[model samples]
Target: MIIHFYNILYAFYENKDIINKVNIGGIIVKNYIIIFAIEAGLTIIYALFSGLNLLNFLNGTFTVSMIGLCIGLFMMMYSDGAYSIMGHSFRKFNYMMAPKRIKETMDEDPDFNKKLRIRQEKYIWTNPILFVSLGLVIISLIAMYSMV
Candidate 1:
C-alpha cells in the first residue's frame, strides 16, 4: 500500500507535469527551488536533530535570508576589474557583474561608458543567482515571521 502511494506521488510530480511549471525571469522555479530545498531541508533536519523545537529552524531561516541578502548586496557592491578611471568605480560602486563584452569594450571602445550605462540599466534583471538570493531572502523572512 505504501509503495503504491509512493509511486502515485512520484508520477504526479514527474518532469512533464505542467502544474509544477513556473517561469521567473526566463529561469525555471524548480531549478532554484531544489537548491532552496536542500539548504532549508538541512536546516530543518538539524533543528529537529538538536531538539530545539523549531527555534533552530527559525535561526536557520534568518541565517539563510541574511546569507542571501549579503550575497546579493555584495554582488552589486563591487565593480569588476576593468576600465574605470582608477578609483572611479570603486568610489561609485557600479555594476560588478558586467558581461565579458562590456568588460572587454570598457577600455578599447570609446562608447564604453555609454554602453556601460545602458548595460547597467538592464542589469540585475538577468542574474539568476541574484534572483534566487532575493527569493530566498523573501521566503525565509516570511517563514521566519510566521514562525515567530
Candidate 2:
C-alpha cells in the first residue's frame, strides 16, 4: 500500500499542473504543517472554551475526535467524487450547463466510474491535507482514550 501510495504521489508530482503549484516552502508549510497546526489549535481551543471544567474537558475530547474524523472522512468522500456530480441539482437549476448542452441526447461518459476511481486513488495518495486531518484524528482519539 505504501509503495503504491508513493508511486501515485511520484506521478502526481511529475505532472505539469502540480509541479507549477509546488515550491519547497509552500509544500512544507503552506500545504502540510500549517494545516495541522490550524486544525489542532482550533480543536483544542474550542474544547477548552466550551469545557472549562475537568469533566467537561474530558467530554470535549470526544467532540475533538469527532471533528477530526469527520474532516478526514469528508475529504475522502469528496475526493471520491461527491460534489463533482451536481446530479439532481443540475437537473433542477440547469446551471451546470445551458439548456442546449443539457438537453443533448447523448449517453453519459462511459468511463466516468473508472476515471472517478483513478482520481480518488490519486487524491488519497497525493493530498497531504487529508493525511494531516487523519493524523489529527489519531491524536485526538489517543487523547480521548488516555484521559478516560
Candidate 3:
C-alpha cells in the first residue's frame, strides 16, 4: 500500500510539469482505464471469497467505487497541476516578501545548494500526498475490518 501510494504520488508529481506541455487528457483517460481494471479484479475477488451477493455488493460498492475512482482519476489528472500552481504561487509570494535571494551566499557553493534544493523540492512534492494517502488507507482498512 505504501509503495502503491508512492507510485501514485511520484507519477503525479513527476508528470506535473509535462502535463501542461503534453496530452494530459489522454494520460488521465489511460489512468482511469487501469484503475477500472483493478477495481473490476477486486470486485471479482470479493464476490468469490466474501460470500457476498455479487449484485448486492456491486450496489453498495458502486458509490464507494465511484468515489475512489474519481479520487484516483482527479489525483492523476490534476494533483501535479494543483501542486505546481500552489508551489509557484507561494514561491512568487515569498520572493516578493523576501529581503533578498537567500541563494546569494550559496552562490559560491552552487553545487551543494543545488543538490539540497533538488532534494527539498522532491520531498515537498511527495510528502503531503503520501501522508494524506496513508491516513485515507488506514481509515479504509479500519472500515473494512469493521464491516467484516
lDDT of 3: 0.48
For model 2, the local distance difference test gives: 0.55
Top-TM-score candidate index: 1
Model 2 Cα shift for residue 83 (angstroms)? 4.9
For model 2, residues 33-119, the per-residue Cα lDDT tens digits are 555566657657876788766545545544554565576677777676665554435444553354665445322544323122223
Candidate 1 per-residue lDDT over residues 6-102, each given as its tens digit: 6446756675553244443455556566656765776677677767766667667666656665765555544332334444555334435667675
Candidate lDDT scores, in order, read: 0.56, 0.55, 0.48
Query: Which is the winner by lDDT between candidate 1 and candidate 2?
Result: 1
lDDT of 3 by residue, 1-148 (tens): 6765565667677775432323332233343344445555665665666567745355334534545545555555454466556656666565456565554544554443222121122222233233333444555555656667
- Please state the error at residue 86 of candidate 3 in Å: 0.9
Global lDDT of model 1:
0.56
Worst 10 residues of 2 by lDDT: 111-120
Candidate 2 clashes between residue pairs 3 or more apart in a chain or in different chains: none
Error of 2 at 128 (Å): 3.3
Specify the highest-lDDT model's number: 1
Lowest summed-lDDT stretch of 10 residues in model 3?
A: 116-125
